[model samples]
Target: MKKRITASLASVLALSTLVACSQAPAGGGEVKSGGEKKEAPAEKVKLSVWHNFSGDDLRAKAVRAQIEKFQKDHPDIELDAQAIPPDGYRQRVKTVAAANEMPDVFFAHAGTGIKEYFDGGLLQPITPLVNKHPEWKNNFMEGALEALSFNNEVYAVPINASVTSLFFYNKSLFEKHGVAVPKTWDELMAAIKTFKEKGVTPISLGNKAAWLAQSSILSSLADRVTGTDWFLKAAKQDGAKFTDPEFVQALTYFKGLADAGAFQQGFNSLDNTQMEQYFIQGKAAMMIDGAWALTNMAATGTKEQLDQVEVTVLPSVPGGKGDPNSLSGGAGGGLAISKKLSGKKLEAAYELIYTVSGPEGMKAVAESNSVVNYKVDVDPTKVTSLFLKAYNLTKQVKFTPVYDAYLSSQGAEAINNGLQELLLGGKPEDIAKKLQDAQAKSLGK
Candidate 1:
């Protein structure tokens, strides 16, 4: 949620293409015999699509490419694609919903946020569409479709699956410092200490935008200590609480990392892109970030540099309730159609969704070093090594949903702000209590 935002020339090109096609000849059929003219064919259906792939990166390019392909395949349909900045995207969608101006199809997350829209009767149920196309639906990974569903109705179609708790480290730096990849909490601390003593930044974190640290680090730490069951119970206000000892211990553990100077100086003032720069420039030994970073690294870093980077789940914690290999991950987000759509407009919107998140689109997503929910065939040589390593690590781990994705908006904000305070010497108990209060209020308890 507003951790960072990126805009690219590809979005501009997409908009330009949409405008250019608006001037093209209409798709209707017309015939004239003698002096009388036959009836004209139906006008092309124009569908407005809003998405957050505004950056000029591989992900954005992949989306644009898919849009072009869709237009080529269906010339009778015109897509008015608008690339919104990610930072304000959620609010923008909310504003549009308030004004009853939601587009025919729009990009949205697959969890609590989307549930809000569904509850408001603003989103279209896509279960029937999925059911009609078994071949298309079967391409998705297990539970993916279900994850995007609410109250037995599917609201969104998952495009990608993202793991946020990955520890991406510079292999060369580890070798230079004589530090092995850590396997346990103790080993991880020792590694941090070693890097610190050698005058190296152990981790690169940027929390000024807030969600970065929560999504990338604390979510995994919480799972390691209290496990996902407790958190889910707490979210539902079903006896579990954030102020429970196990949850507090998780906050304490995260504070310990900050106390040990694991993160770079002024980390809270920097943004995620800046943190990436620190890792890319070798100023920091490792970075805790989402799977999206791998795609960025593949696009910007050299082959050797990309090869030197490796990813792994957070190290095991002693006495932890969760599986040592459990990772904070889930379906990142997906496209949803408006409830008002029907007939040809609905068909065109469904086609757009399928083309972007289906087998063909997923192949492009995989080749760009990103993971997709769709089980598409991809050439191994086309995928980056970083992606392969990350993919393998995910396969070996159990997945815990990302905090913000599962929590109510207010509860999520509370944790994000509370964790930011932890970096400033806030006490674990105090932070835990604050989160508990927020969660209680969100649940109206």
Candidate 2:
């Protein structure tokens, strides 16, 4: 769910102007005119929330519905929810942060991405709040809260967990082409060749938005090549380097796919939505995307179309150190509070976070076919078969962190831009060096 913003620099600079104006604090109870001094009614607390649920998809609907319920239950709190597009969300957050105008509560990812805000003193530590509510802490799945923590302090509330490196294929197309489900790199390549021979795009990928390939394809490829251990070491600049053969091999393999015409024509120009449409229209045989996409697929496609789709992990790479079943995703996204919030504003923020990340919100997310981090009582029969398959697969696999989530913004941008370059005839070794250079600069090595 991470994306780089294409927002204008002027708008970002303008955010600084908004920061000078501060929100007025809520007024306390007033004394009555009577000699018997009766306390006056409490004033409504207004909170501004920023989130990336902008579309009319099921995920958006679920979020909107939860906001409505929260407003209904807490009439004293006035919530001003703004739905920013995913592409511009990170930039918007940065702009607000630069202005010192962060909303009361804002949507954020749960790893190194949030660490930036934590380091910058923009986010409020919520560990004490979680500790106070044992019920809330108990509801989260193991490691859910921890993923959102830094240096033993939790900063955000995880809403949903996800597996990003899933390959969703058109089952009917596979059957039509007499291609068996691939279990290894060779088999996958052979299928790609076969599909190409039959005038079908083997995989539908759109990189114009820039993050799709990195999050979905390259993340899984890195796992299959050097595994999670190497990635972590390399990211930390402990000893490993991106120019190492294993890492370069992963890039080379990714480049090979692009050269072999595995993806659609003009893939670099198509956005994520267009790529999904290509798969749904049967123009492509397979699509590599996050598990959250199931909700949208189920909401937009017919039952037959849903039945025609099947999910699987990336195929195993030969002589690799990684487990073939290792997946690339974790706690997908969460909510963080502004450090400026306190008293009633802070209380309302906590309630909103819990409402969205706790049982009530988790249930809605699960029912929509997306996996959630909280332990909600979801009816198995009510879940989509596609989601059930993903859920079951997730249980059987080792989860690896998404590259973008694990790397700093600078390092992530390097990998993302490098991948795009690699696909467009750039050398894998060169791309690796570029990434290495970016990592070094980011780490001040």
Q: What TM-score do all the candidates reach, one by one? A: 0.88, 0.85
TM-score of 2: 0.85
Give candidate 1's whole-model lDDT. 0.84
What is the lDDT of every predicted structure here?
0.84, 0.84
Write one digit per residue (lDDT tens) for candidate 1, span 286-392.
89999888877776688877888888888888999987787788887789989999999999988888888877887887777777766666687978878888877
Error of 1 at 130 (Å): 1.4
Off by over 4 Å in 2: 1-38, 133-136, 380-383
Candidate 1: clashing pairs of residues? 8-56
Clashing pairs in 2: none
Candidate 1 runs further than 4 Å off: 1-37
